[model samples]
Target: MTAYLPMDREERREMLASVGVDLDHLFDSIQESQKLKKTDFSGLQQEGISELEVVERLTALADLNKRTDDYDSYLGAGFYDHYQPAAVNHLISRTEFLTAYTPYQAEISQGTLQAIFEWQSYISRLSGMDVSNASLYDGASAAAEAALMACREKRLYKVFVSAGMHPEYIETIETYCHAAGVEVEVGALNEAGKTAEFPTEKGYAAYMVQSPNFYGVVEDLPLLVEKAHATGALAGASCDLISLALLQRPGDLGVDIVTGEAQALGIPMSFGGPGVGYMAVTQKLLRKMPGRIAGETVDRDGKTSYVLTIQAREQHIRRERATSNICTAQALMATSATIWLALMGSSGIRDVAEQSAAKALYLQEKLLATGLFENTYDSPVFREFALTAKGSLDLYKLNQDLLAEKIFGGLVVDDNRWLLAVTEKKSKQAMDKFVETVVRLAQAQ
Candidate 1:
């Protein structure tokens, strides 16, 4: 048994008093019907245990999980399993970088500000845009924020989003639109899994699409952007950062805003997050972009310095006048991304992208040759693709079987449709094993 320090009634009262609130006052806003009559501790141990015992208990619980390292995973909808360089962790784990907060006092925080400046520079180059913010929450929220920025810039109440965009990103955009009194119209996807058409309305604020979209099909961005321009709406793209190394930059393709999840740039999936969201905009929408922007300047000593240039968020400006309500940037995650990019450089990133694309193509061809799966779309893909199970094959059961063989299969997007992802980390041997297992399972079915 371990000695425990429980807060007595007197201690609780004292703490509450110090905060200038009573227990009832704290719960005043909560609905009576929703209030819990008693706390439920059903799953917890009733008695306290020693520190060592607590660690052992937690370890036992953790061991119950099917960790990715133990299995060959093909799961990448938005988050990917890219190779994270050892330097990313080593540099990010430094006490100065780990504990640093928002660089509000740039005079004393040059290192943090410089890291952010470098991150912004990298994103600007990656997206081929005029300006990039320090960072946002994640890819979904970044897309939503871009929609808000477009609405504000175009001064319109309606926005058009492609059906090919990630479902979660669409949902997030809808949530932001609902709060901002804006309307979202979802465009249709053609047989090739590209946005087929855009609303021919003149009042639309923006038309958004994702390259290597949810179906893993790259859209004809130039055509889509042309159509959006015809309707006087700015075109926005939520792209995969890694694909940008091989694909043409959205900015060069005339996209007004480019946003994406930067997780592939050395950040671990960690069961889906703490990923950095990067946003870049053309010169026209630069001032309207959300989050923080780091700008280079000269100090009193005539040396170079980096400082927060534009903060259009609610925390920095008057509430009603603010461009957005975003309060802070993902400084640590952004630093990791910056370091990753610095380490990989341009050629290394291109190599990773090319390898991923090649592996995906190889896997797709092998699976299709097995006659067990059919292609969901006939478009070119960067790293991921969708396949439909042939005949009466059950995708759920197939995935379970794959798991049994220590191979985590693709993510099931719809009925009998699996969205499979391939990364540079997946070797040819692993690919062959996955294909063989799928072929055997199809035969069994």
Candidate 2:
């Protein structure tokens, strides 16, 4: 037990004894190094802290983060620095919206269910898929769950993932596959930062790719999807959701499943997450999608009504038939996304996508002109791109210096490479200043 908690040692021992397990047995599945000890935090003072002290402590810790309020961020691997409209926050905080967690009571949860239905509608239209679920945990889990859905559909144990996909997402897929006794094969990417052609062999349940993939280089979605279909495998994409505003819809490109992180849709990075994941599928695969789906209908009196419709998760069906164990939706974040989308109508979203892409190109050009960075691939980027550091460029020191100036430099990918992202919020002046700083720092190094 944690020292901070109010439980006494004897009570804890008694509780465990009643359950027929010791402390060690309770934590046996966890790695020994990760198991927390009594001394981990030094515990709170016996008298406890006042509200003011707690606020002071939290504020102090928050100040330690070298983030916005004084910084320009250029980091994006999965999450981004897209502008979050004030309206999104203002609307989602209303008592009628904020307090509702689940739509268990159809009659009482009309507002919550309606928000979810709109979310699903927006996602379905964005991906050009037949339908969408309410929500998933995050991009990684969404991709992993899509892979499982594909495997179940094809009744095949093997799946292939593009190396261009985010490394962490690939790791998540592997973890899920391992548990289900499925085989995962990682396909290589060509010099262009797109997944290479599938091996000259065929048996795969699915082939998953990420557009504007981890390298920030866009993939050839149509070609990849065709290749997957040629092998009788379902084609899926873990997309960069904002890019969908301008890029071809995955469904139109024959992508059978579309899964992605919606953090850019008005949600803050919040130091990497609490991301909301979305999954959209073709009509044929709708039954196998995990999580709940909100639907619109008419009440007996001919009044509009909203309710949870298709629920194929472990919570709704027999354990053996359930598509996934996920029981609840990330309703709050999903509602935020819906609000974001509603505020940023189609043209608004398109403008953001276009400006982000243009800014990315402008920054990439400016960086190359500094002669301290070189393009890593010939492929076009959306809002993020990778560049290799030139000679004598101290990437770490450069970032540290930038940090002192209240600016987050590019994400360090490796010793010789770094990835930079540009959002609609990053103006041309910021890009120019970033380039000038890089040049001066590299010259000094």
Candidate 3:
């Protein structure tokens, strides 16, 4: 379809007249409350400039927003600045993989299907589940879908999420459930920063918790799963893909559903997106899973082939009865994850996770030694932890100071509490500098 853009006012008017439509009719679906009252761009006008000059101006503008190398960001709410191996991008950028669209013909799109199959296998192994779908928008949507999937078994309509889950994920589940008349109950986080029980029992289909949760504290997966099952609710555990290398697998903990953002696996942060969400479940719940699931099969000659199977649960076939409305998702990122996993193998991945945890513990101890901050929770954590800053400390001001020093401070949870995260990427010297910066800031305060 051609875009009906008019180069001149006369052409715009003529097209509107020919279509028997006014500007209002052209955008009739936009609610009055949702529409902006006036165009803000109307006041922004610039004189004629050459295309080269405009390009130069844009380059300068981009530089202004570009973060300098000196700044070390510790922020990771949903997105993290993990190191992505060059091979990951090189493989994903292959012409066939980069340009591929959704595979509609199972027979002809074997390459795409095979990649999805590998993605499913990796996710399944990581979560300790029997099966996984291709991918989803992100971790939050995946969590929401897991809730709906649990509802399929018992026809219950409520979802219980722990406050330890990323707040954004909790909000995403609520947004999805509201339209479906599914109530969401959020449980509180205990002093250990793990999710506690809900005040009252409700007919919930699923209970979602996060290990190495939003506050950077790990939850008690075995106990949490047991409690959820006692109420006949499915237990869904969201985890950091990298952390699973050291921690107990969600499936090993007896979780029915496991899902999380896979960005830390291999993909770049990419400004918080284009990240894939991985979901895996026991084979017993496979039929209720959403999104495209690639399966392996043989041809008439017994030659191996890959195909997308069991898709009747999706929107096009099931309509309102569909498991989910998610159609297409981050296949390219999923491919990146597959390549990264293959490159690292099991041992290499485990080393990365262990090294990251060690570095984080080193930083935690150093920070506490300064007597300016202390660990907020008493539980064992992964690569991230909550620290309580002392004195008349202003997080915004401290961050500003850290910015000037070319060091990114930890994420501020409150005026006095911050969440710090470390990875294999940061070296000993950098970690020392970060600690020195924090100590100086504390002394000044």
Question: What TM-scores do the predictions have?
Answer: 0.92, 0.89, 0.88
What ranking emerges by lDDT with the best candidate at the front?
1, 2, 3
Which residue pairs overlap in candidate 3's backbone? Answer: none
Residue by residue across 131-233, what tens digits does model 2's lDDT show?
Answer: 9999999999999999999999999989999998999999999999999999999988898888877755678999999998998888988887888888899
Off by over 4 Å in 3: 1-54, 68-70, 198-202, 317-319
Model 1 lDDT, residue 20, Cα = 94
* Model 2: how far residue 25 lies from native, Å: 17
lDDT of 1 by residue, 1-445 (tens): 3446789788999999998979768888899999989888799878889989989989999988786788899999998888888988999998779888877888988999999999999999989999999999999999999999998998898899999988999999999999899999998898888888778769999999999898789888898789899999999999988899999989898999999889989788888889999999988887788888889999999999998886633455556567787868899999998999999999999999999999999999999998888999988988999998888999998898998898888999777899999999999998998898888876786
Q: What overall lDDT, based on C-alpha atoms, would model 3 receive against the true structure?
A: 0.84
- Note the residue pairs that clash in candidate 2: none
The local lDDT score (0 to 100) that residue 4 gets in candidate 2 is 56
lDDT of 2: 0.87
Number of backbone collisions per candidate: 0, 0, 0
Candidates in order have lDDT scores of 0.89, 0.87, 0.84
The TM-score of candidate 1 is 0.92
Cα displacement (angstroms), candidate 1, residue 161, comes to: 0.8
Whose lDDT is greatest here? 1
As a whole number from 0 to 100, the lDDT of residue 349 in candidate 3 is 92
